[model samples]
Target: MQKIGFSGTLDPITNGHMWVIGEARSIAEEVVVFLSENSTKAPKFSAEERKAIVLASCAERGWNNVAVQIVKSEYTARVAKRNGVGYLIRGIRSTADFDYENLIQQTNVEVIGGAKTLFVMPPRDLGSVSSSFVKALEGPVGWNWTMKKFVPAPAYKAWILAWLRKEWDSLWRERPHSAEWFERLTGEQAYGGAERHYHNLDHLVHGLAEIRAWAANTGAAPAHVALVKAAFWFHDAVYAHAAGEVSNEEASARLWLGSGLEPDAVRAEEVATLIRATDHFQGGAMLHPLKDTMLSVDLAILGQEAEVYQAYATGIRAEYAHVPEADYNSKRAQILAHLRGKAEAGTLFADPFFTDNYTAAAIANMSAELALIAGR
Candidate 1:
């Protein structure tokens, strides 16, 4: 099977790139889109986000033979050769594009003796669409119905969420003592730790974003919002990598109480209670609204799309690398089965926001994972 390489920043993949990928598919048995980063040029999205967008786009289009990857090196020819790609594909929309790509093609040929570069010109309708053009339309007011035509649905959704996250981060930066302080402290504990993979800074950020959105829409009280945010930060602060050794939730809550981040004894106790609610092992009714919200947010990963959920599962396995596979799968299945039961009962989340939007998907994802583990 012949493998073809397509390299670009793909900041936000456009219809033009899809057209070129289709053309590459016709010529090569397998196609890999390399989400390359250039030091001289600033990217609108991170490399990981770009790769996810590409993968999601491919999944939506049913492009089974196309794979998306992040390229660490700027040397295109060497990357292609290392990936077993025999040909490199580039799209040319005009004379300028042709002129620019021709120079790179010549250099690539010299770098990899036997590799080839193929130029594809998109159809007239898509020729004008580019990443730069899509990026220009990115803003709170610019992403309208018309802008949707140029980008794939999955990519557009990912880009919008990423943009929203950036805005939220900026807003928190302005108030460094509150949201930003928790962000920095939790970020260090989660991302800098050696045993973290799934329950890391990114996971906390996602949880915070979800809670913020829900709080905004529901007109939640400022105090309630603050409490939930604190829970999100400390829920997994002391992630226990091994199974059944100690309760991470308890340790995290104790750490939060002693840190003096929240000196008020009453609110500090509330935050600790919310963090313990995330321990799905102790199944029971939530004692308060804040605890309910925190529990739902912690289980939100169950409702993500299949690809994203699969990645979450993979990260979790990586975190428990010390555990034997059979034992790990057994423990994981038990937890998922418990969640699945709650999901099926329509009581997974006390909040209407999560119950209405995520209940069905969460149940389905948990069932799927349980089956996979059983089969293995």
Candidate 2:
């Protein structure tokens, strides 16, 4: 009853492909290898030939519960579910592949309710070996490229090409300013979520807007403004289905690098580092360049007048509504704890506007909110 499925086309499976299958087989009671067709990519063999080769390969290795079959449909999840398979396996070789594959896994869940995708990282020795590289050299270089020795007989080169092509298409097509792109890239929308989930595009934009206003009021340095604004947009770039604490920082760097911002690499790196520093809410002790940036971002929420604070705060609550109640509560507590801890340590607000008039205002605003939960 332990059925596992692998969907690919074996034009010439590589050693990396075979390694993943070997590892998958050890963990599954039965392995169903599905040779996918209807691919718009290079194919060196017919689907029937590839299926037979896969069967022979599994048999040669004496692997039980290994069956090779063809799936004509494009839906890998539907095929797996029909076969009573519970696991969808993918092979990851690099960070780029991981990012691309992670998106697919998230989409699969949406496409097929309860379907899961598990990625197995290829061993370091085989990390750089891919079918594409081999195929590109096979014809002109006159090199033998039969993947039977390295890949399972059922491995489909066409399927991998299609997967890569699809990923590339999506990546190239993504619009930086499109709400549709935002939904496709991340499960969350720019606005309207739970209180604990308030950090989104709108929140980031709001934070930057406030940063600009605070800068204008205080005559802040231009470099500080640019760094802060870049961090605001890039901070959430690496968000995935199961993002963790450092997701913001990681994504920031990825976005900066992908955007070919290398000439400003130092500043971009500093921006990423500053965003990470914001996670710690100690008032003034934050790292040099970004400590002020963090205060600006934080104060942007609580330093406003009562009317402005209430209006922004309402939107903040809605942005986080999708977050589970428990998670929402925990994050809210963390933010509050950070604020309290920062104030106690004398690091909460260091900028001129905050140092002069907004410091007490920010504290008073959060104090009221904290008191609401403190008594509960």
Candidate 3:
């Protein structure tokens, strides 16, 4: 065929969608990605945004034969025919998907002078990879690594930024100065700074997930939940590129205090204190439950699966790229040794839940990392 059309809403465009596009490209000299609008449900990205993501992926793949266009009408046959598309390509992941798409295939083929339907299936491993499935991985720890496997190269970072925007918007939907506050936190000089490999907004997403998960289990009050969420959001808001110069926790706490949310004096001070608790070295004296929860969640990466912990350690190293390897490794080993001492003393995690679940894993992870650092 001279031309084939691949049509869908493609809210964020996953690898599964790309597989179908590849199939279309293989069968036709040219492929048109028809980004259609669905009025029944709102999409995460607009037509133009989705088109941009698709185009980026196409460019990344060096697909000169592919093009993207927004389609206004829901009817696929007339649109495909008008575009000179000889076939409309669709992806079938399972019998259920085939059942749904077969009806559309019949409709298109029945239309006078309309394009024929071409059904393609991705690899079995990608059968379950959908836009929604990829979207669900946005907040959990080590999500970036997992998401990278499913998203196209060009869309991975874009997806993270969009997810962060949504999360930041949701966090401050009812609050004042949201726009200004979010900009500062995500700007190049702050959490979104290029140096923030480990302490970036994605880290906040993981922390927020931990908070919500804790709340879900403990039935914590909404106020406490809100406080902790906000604290987590702004905890690393002002990470300086160099570690242990000025207190990043103190600066971030100040940023949170003056963030224009208009919290009363007590609330503001309490939040500042909560933010400061992230500075693990200055934190042993803290005995409050909320404080304990914040500290534990912030350190929870140490207890994540082995691969995730290794990634976290590598990111931390990347952030301190200015330092010489020997000095960096020496300082890192010192910090790990300090934390290991705390873990051995049975005071590494304060929250009883984390103390029981994460303390041992955290110790093991840190010790392993420490050994690696020493060997180097």
Per-candidate clash tally: 0, 21, 0
Which pairs of residues clash in candidate 1, taking residues 3 or more apart in a chain or in different chains? none
In candidate 3, what residue range of length 10 has the lowest lDDT sum? 280-289
Against the hidden true structure, what lDDT does model 2 obtain? Answer: 0.60
Q: What lDDT tens digits, residue by residue, belong to model 1 across residues 1-376?
A: 4899888889889988988998989998999897787777778778888888888888898999998877775576677787798788889999999998888888788755645789888889998899899887754221433356899987775665455456445434444255544454544465435567778654655677677767877899988988888777777888765565558877778877876666678988888888888775642543765777887788777787676677778889998888899999999999899888988899987788889878987888888899999999
Superposition TM-score, candidate 1 onto the true structure = 0.56
Ranking by TM-score: 3, 1, 2
**Model 2 misplacement above 4 A:** 1-197, 237-246, 280-290, 311-334
- TM-scores of all predicted structures: 0.56, 0.41, 0.86
Which ten-residue region of model 2 has the weakest summed lDDT? 139-148
lDDT rank order: 3, 1, 2
Model 1: lDDT equals 0.76
- Could you tell me the TM-score of candidate 2? 0.41
Candidate 2: lDDT of 201?
Answer: 33
Question: Model 2, 96: alpha-carbon shift in Å?
Answer: 64
Q: Given candidate 3, what's the lDDT at residue 303?
A: 82
RMSD of 2: 19.9
